[model samples]
Target: MTVIDNTHQRLLPAPAADVGRLLDRIGRPGDPLWPSPTWQPMRLDRPLSVGATGGHGPVRYHVSDYRPGRLVEFTFDPRIGLTGTHTFEVIDHGDDACVLRHRLVATPSAHMRPLWPALIGPCHDTVLEHLLDNAEHAVTGTVTDPVRYPWQARLDVRLFSVQVNATSVPQNALLLEAALPPAAGPRSDLADAYAARVPPGVTTDPQAWADAIFGNPPPAVTALFRLRNALVTPFGIERGDRSAFDTISRTDRELLLGTDAGHLDFRASILVEPDDDGVTVTLSTHAVAHHRTGRLYLALVRLFHPPVVRAMLRRAAAAAVRPRPVTPPGLPTTTPLR
Candidate 1:
């Protein structure tokens, strides 16, 4: 087995003690500044101490060493491919600043070699950068450059499949299935309302409402829709741009949004069909993986697709039932659908 090491660091404009205090709270689930959007927050079975078991999402690990306001190390489970330690340490940089570092030193087994550079490495870099940005925000009250996924990293992990029950407010299907011309697309009022409530730096363009049915959307209106879809399907894909929604397909009952991300092609639809009581809205996605890495990367995604899709669908259903104001006629809007 060959050893592979990855390290990422950020300088905070604060003292070591202040930085360490923030580091101590890094893995706590639901922390406002913890970067849960980039990397799912870690849920630990016990408090931050040696021997506590916890990991974020699918990765499981146990704490091997711990020190308050200084360092913590998690030794990942062997089943996760590489066997090694992931450590977070805080060091004094000067009277005014401190450096926070995350280091992963692991030896991968033969079978895991292809996965490193292709999938894991890119995702790791993305999540780490966001985490650092989160730390800076904690100390400085602002993030200089909010984290955005690199194009390659976004392409490598994009996968979308979700279904949501819009039975409570069946009219949601109408809103969900609304179409825009391939060029100047019409905005979805419901989506715009939702997007306005999202935090800064996220997009709320109405076109995103369709593209989000199957892609990983940023922390914008698409994300809100994805959460709604999660009520039925728990999974989604993320990318940085609206280029994914460039092409449009529409029928009386369905609306499709399509785009190509490098070597991968993505097509997603919102289908509205009548049911026993109200309408049933189904959001589905299909992808054409173009190369060897694409196939292999998607294979990994398939393992978690079912749960991810279901979660997204369930959430979307719940959201549809919430009351919202309808956009009035003749009101000025963003754009018009041809």
Candidate 2:
């Protein structure tokens, strides 16, 4: 019970329920293990296991209490020389806003505490910073750039382009083509919702299939989904989740939100499946509007249209699966979610 270390304050943009629901979705009972999350089964009423293997040796953890969304605590075996608790709490900020808090409580064995400064102190700040970013996205629908805790908040602005395509292997045939603007246009915010029935392996790659598509996408995608709704000014739209367009990069981009007086966010996700003959990949993309009036500005940008976006992505997918037969001037060929 000695407080060897603690991170007292972590704030998130979402309300309590949203954050809680998300935690349940990722670490709930029956959910498969995700690498090595700090929380363990002992913390929940459901069954759970704890252990990590990597550059470091194995570390085991014990869970103590589970209150789904409200709180989860963990105590390590004395052999591990560490005990800790993590709590997620929601508080009312105003009629329109809520605060989510994440806290860490830790005690290290005599041998580990003094070494904490050299061993774990540097990372504690980073872990808390990451938690704040994740929590904000979970509730607010935007992925804010990493910021320092309790001080010096900066703003982040960005633009994204996403494309999706479908093709059949062996036959090297193109199936369907689509994107946000509906046909060939770009900047179309329309959600490009499609269904495909294809053969397995014809679509998803081995390990990537389960990770990028089949599973629930990572938190960034969820944040994007939430932020997409709050854009009131420029009013924007999404074709698919941001995860579907992993090729897109955020570097060397114009800023979207500022620290002093701005919003923070970005997100993406995609899902793919194979059927009898081919695979179907669903892509969803979203953008955030900054100023209260920016929503209309963005929605008007819809001039780019969605159909055109889909066509381009489809062509790309076709090319990947099967080379398009080139008849001098004309030829065609063939893609997923987070």
Error of 1 at 111 (Å): 2.2
- Residue 78 displacement in candidate 1 (angstroms): 0.9
lDDT of 2 by residue, 75-181 (tens): 55556666665544555555544555556566778887775666455444444454554555445444335333221111000000112443222111112122112
What lDDT is reached at residue 28 by model 1? 60
Q: For candidate 1, write residues 74-133 as lDDT tens digits.
A: 998989887999999988888978788899999887777888887877777776776776
Taking every candidate in turn, the Cα RMSD to the unseen true structure, in Å, is 18.1, 22.1
Best candidate, lDDT-wise?
A: 1
Task: TM-score each candidate.
Answer: 0.50, 0.35
**Where does candidate 2 have its weakest 10-residue lDDT segment?**
152-161
Question: In model 1, where do residues sit more than 4 Å from their true spots?
Answer: 155-338
